[model samples]
Target chain A: MTTTVCGRCKSSGAVTDHQGRQDGAVVWTILRCPTCNFSWRDSEPARAIDPAARSVDFAVDADDLQRYPKILQQ
Target chain B: MNDLPNRARSISSLRDFLELLEDSGQAITWSDPVMPEPGVRNIAVAASRDANGAPAIVFDNITGYPGKRLAVGVHGSWDNIALLLGRPKGTTIRELFFEIAGRWGDQEAQISFVPEAQAPVHECRLEQDINLYDVLPVYRINEYDGGFYIGKASVASRDPLDPDNFGKQNVGIYRLQIQGPDSFTLMTIPSHDMGRQIMAAEREGVPLKIAVMLGNHPGLAVFAATPIGYEESEYSYASAMMGAPIRLTKSGNGIDILADSEIVIEAELQLGERELEGPFGEFPGSYSGVRKAPIFKVTAVSHRRDPIFENIYIGRGWTEHDTLIGLHTSAPIYAQLRQSFPEVTAVNALYQHGLTGIISVKNRMAGFAKTVALRALSTPHGVMYLKNLIMVDADVDPFDLNQVMWALSTRTRADDIIVLPNMPAVPIDPSAVIPGKGHRLIIDATSYLPPDPVGEAHLVTPPTGDEIDALSKRIREMQLGALS
Candidate 1:
């Protein structure tokens, strides 16, 4: 039961795997715009990095435009 | 007279800001042989320290753009702010925000009308079937950027549905994706105030007409894009910031346009249901994925005499987005916290891909630390991406990462920090459910030293600026002597 299409291409098109990884974690994140059918990914950005630190961590859930609600921490 | 942004006065028609890159006494021009083909184009927005310890950016001569005015530093530095305010930039951000957010005694927009004269945007006007690729300087910044997005573009539009809301033209700075001839979409973040307004208009079946302001003084563009209170308008705020009303005119369809705007792209947002907006480099030095956002449809275009289009490179700390949006928003947050935490020092809207924020605070008491943290996290801004919050003593400048790290190393501890994991999270964040929301941690690193040792911070930090400058001078002199 595939609920959502492949996020990168946005065509409901998908292969088994993909590319672009950071620190062995899947670096490229694919998402499909529900309305426009335009598909894109959260890929590696290009502005200068600190040189020391390779990348900043992106909370997979921190994706909502507004305060995408997180489960309150105790 | 001031014409387009970053452009020299009195030019012919529209040009890209990249044409104006001045040689920094270098041997040869670095960027050449690279035309803005589909993949080889990139604009580097760099922030380095000026003589006065303020930040300045350099727009390196882009490869493909020859004789185009390059936008070096549009986020006007402190000195530039002083020029804008007509007062000293020595006034701290706290003071600036408090003055702006606070009620100025009997302050109002006093209009000085110019009957279509003295305005610079009237240099050349192209109506209908306008091909943006030819007239203005549009760079294909990166290979993956959907296409050449006019990096810096703001919309001046009146609500199409409501005639009364005509005067409410928002200078919405959005990444303009050039779709085709006479077609584009304002790919701004959906949560921006302008986005919400467009959505509301669309709900009632209204077209969002906008006249964009690209490449102006950093003060106008950055401050205008700031999302203040729901009722607050950026134009008015910019006017107040400039110590004068931002002079504007009525463009087509009731849009209040900036008469002094460098480049004015008159257009309307489709305000249709939605479209995928990103994959563009975000300020946090990461690719922000696609989200359903309102796309704009261009109608007409206008500009100052030979206007220079400004572009901001997102994806890192010093990018134009950080200099423009980050500090602009941080000012108000500092103002709001002042009401509760009066002694609050500074708030650093650190761009960790729109994630973390590190604030420097003046500790009033033991419990005051956490209170400051809670107040900051709860402040009404789109701070959903704030993950790491640091509280330092007022002595430390929050803008200085070194000082922040020093506070963390010397004063903060694991036990003294407040961590809220799994809090309201945004999806784009790899750690959150949504990209705009997330867990927040407050690291209270304010010094808790013994009272006696705290007597007047001795020239304690040593003359960092002077020593470094002297050493660099010595090295340069030594090289000169050797050559001689």
Candidate 2:
């Protein structure tokens, strides 16, 4: 399995899956981080899918997910 | 003034409205190959930023996405909003606000239920091998968005406690982030109608079914984002606004949706499941921090042939979200306030979902303006979002920022500013010290009455007559002649 790192939180457990097709050829791959639940497309810009290039305003820390408030308590 | 027939009211679907916009020179179709990422978003941002008339942009050629279409900036400008309201392109914001306010509770317009075989949205159904990325022209709305979002769809849900009541059914617009092929997360606060229903279902340990309708009639979108009472139906209001019956059909989840919607995804919210949702650029011109939100599992997806995916840019003040929701927000507040206090002249809650409101009222007595402001704060939508309110005299036009500023400068006294602490607030407000609670401010900008200290002040009144109107018309004609 090819290792994938999340772009927003830099988690190493991110999974990549082929999405959509053009002429029976895969057009893009979607990368999703289970830790932070951030998803990005391989076809997106570097700023959107690269941790080092992503905006600081939107950067996520996987550890912060524990402290994030639940909008509705289950 | 050019008096044209109100053709917008007859529009049945997003494509029908797009055709109307194209005929009215309010929309443009780009046939060139455009990248899905920054290219479509960048063009949409430019169109949204155009304070001048910006046309709805339809991109027919997206690289890698064959036979797909995406529409943006459908409600991005005042001119486009005017056209959506069946008015002339140059209709003033105040006129639009009052036009919507005038039809506040007129539910005379009917809704017609159609069979699935007759519904255009059911022309194609995908129940097996559901992949949202393959189905939709999914693209990031902002550079830092967590993922592709369905930001403009009308989400229909019924109250879990009163499922059979049609009036208790709700159609709203909430941001949905795609997480997997058939899974996504929806963010909503408890204050929202959908949020309340979700909370109820979670407490009862029952799955809440929903129908997400995309590319609907323009009027349906307007009402979806509107703040109406829980018992009121968005379809009724949308039909009233359109001056025609809305076509409807039941989804697989048994939720009523617009029959002419380009696409409908039937889903069920997992009762106890929560997932990381946001950190997306919100309407407040700031990124909403990540939060745990409800997860939805899609059961079926239905669409028309070659469906057009509709999306809205919702980053800052002047995007499609503000233009799409501004009049709806203002009209409800104005109607609610007017019902209690007819002295209330107008309400301008067009900024940041009524976080800050400017109200024009006829001051009955010394503290009448304050009373109106207080009542405004208690209005259904105002209770949660009306953080700062400015009260002005009836003579001051609430829609005109220049006149409002002049009133603020001249009529406001230092002691007239009242701040109430620890009030409920919209969670997305960046300035809130606590996420969902903040202080409420009221600036009484009305002139002091007899009981209060009245300093010697003489306000200038502008000259108004038919001669000035004629001269103004002549000057406009001369300016056009000069341009020619």
Candidate 3:
């Protein structure tokens, strides 16, 4: 089986969240990274689904996800 | 509904308003197939640039999305705004501002509740095996946005502690980033009512239930973007704006929503859960950096048949965001200021969501203008976003930038500018050096009073008379005749 990696965080734990179907057939799958909660549709442009082509400005490091400020404190 | 005037009850749904736009030649339908990415966003951007006479564009043929329709720039121009208010296309911005301000006192506006069967929004329900992509024509609004966003929905949420208090319930517009088939994240600052509700929910360790209503009535959209009192009900204000009673129905979660909404997504903000969101194009014409926001899990989805997905392009200035929120923002501040100071004539806060404001007032004493400016800074919307304010004399028209500039140039003195440092500000403001804290500036551009005699001696007055008006009309007719 091929492993799906998250484009924004490059996390290997990316899992399929849902599928998009047009007629009776599935056209694309939405994959989400559990580490950073980043998601992308498989059929999207390479810039949005491929880590190497994605803009560095929006890329997130899974380990550094904790650094992002939480909007509200529990 | 019975007490409303004929014009106020004319438009009850988005489709009814769209029909009005068509009849008035204010909307167009694109029949050719176009890519959803750049096609929709680019068309919206081009239409928004006109700012005055842009028509709402409906893309009927979107590639890969058969039978799905997307409407853009529905409220992107003043002409469309005037049409929404049941006025002529040629209504001036000042006239429109006052029209809305005049209706601000309709706190007793009526709202009628309908049964689920009577609500058109409940025509279709997708409670099982739901996929947002399959239902909604979700597409990235901006190229670099982190994900597809529902930017134009009127999100309805109640104060968790006082869920039954209708007045405490809030209906406002907030950006929703679609993360999965049944999941999304919403962005709200601490100052917004939604933010306060979230804080309350978090403190109580409970999920915050919300019903996101899309493609709502134009009046609802206007009041949703408005900055009103925390306890004020947007539905009632929307009724006031429409001059008729607004029809509403309860969602699966018991949240009230527009009966004519094209789509309704019932969701809950999970407790103690945060997710990576944003880096989306924001209203400040810049991309909002990534932050951890609250995650929402969809519980049920309902919509009318063949739902028309409504979205907005919110990058930079002069977009629908400005036109949608501008006048509504100005009217409330004007109404609030007029309560304390009847000498205040007009207010213009159309620039970048009231970050800069202009006020015209009749100065009573030496420092009265400055006092009015300070009082404005305390208005509901002013406290957070009114960073720079310009004070003008009662003779000047705040809506007319030419007059405002003339006042700034001729009446302003170097010593009249006051700066208050480290004040609360809109976090998305790109000029904010420290995210949510910035300096406030007030320029007393009104002419000096008794103590100051400089430049108060000789001032040229503008000529005005009935003869001038008659000549102006004759000359305009002559010019048209010559062109023809």
The candidate that achieves the highest DockQ relative to the unseen native structure: 2
Look at candidate 2 and give me any clashing residue pairs. Answer: none
* lDDT per residue as tens, model 3, B1-484: 1222355367788888888888778899988877666677878898899888898888878765778988888898999998887777756788799888887786568788999998999999988877787778766788778778899989999889999999999999999998877888999998899999998999987679999999989889889989988998999888877787789999989999999999999999988788889878998889888888999999999999988888888898889999999999999999999999999999999988899999999999767899999999999999999999999999898988999999999888888899999998888888886889999999999987877665474877767556765676678779979998
Kindly report the fnat of each predicted structure, to 2 decimals.
0.04, 0.69, 0.42
Cα RMSD of all models vs. native, in order, equals: 10.1, 2.0, 3.1
| i-RMSD per candidate, Å | 13.4, 1.8, 2.5
Better of 1 and 3 by lDDT: 3
User: lDDT tens digits, residues B296-393, model 2?
Assistant: 99999999999999998889768888889988898888988888999998999989888889999999888789999999889999899899999999
Q: After superposition, how far is residue B148 of candidate 3 from its true place, in Å?
A: 0.8
| TM-score list, all predictions | 0.69, 0.96, 0.93
- Best model number under lDDT: 2
TM-score of 2: 0.96
Q: What is candidate 2's CAPRI-style docking category based on DockQ? A: medium
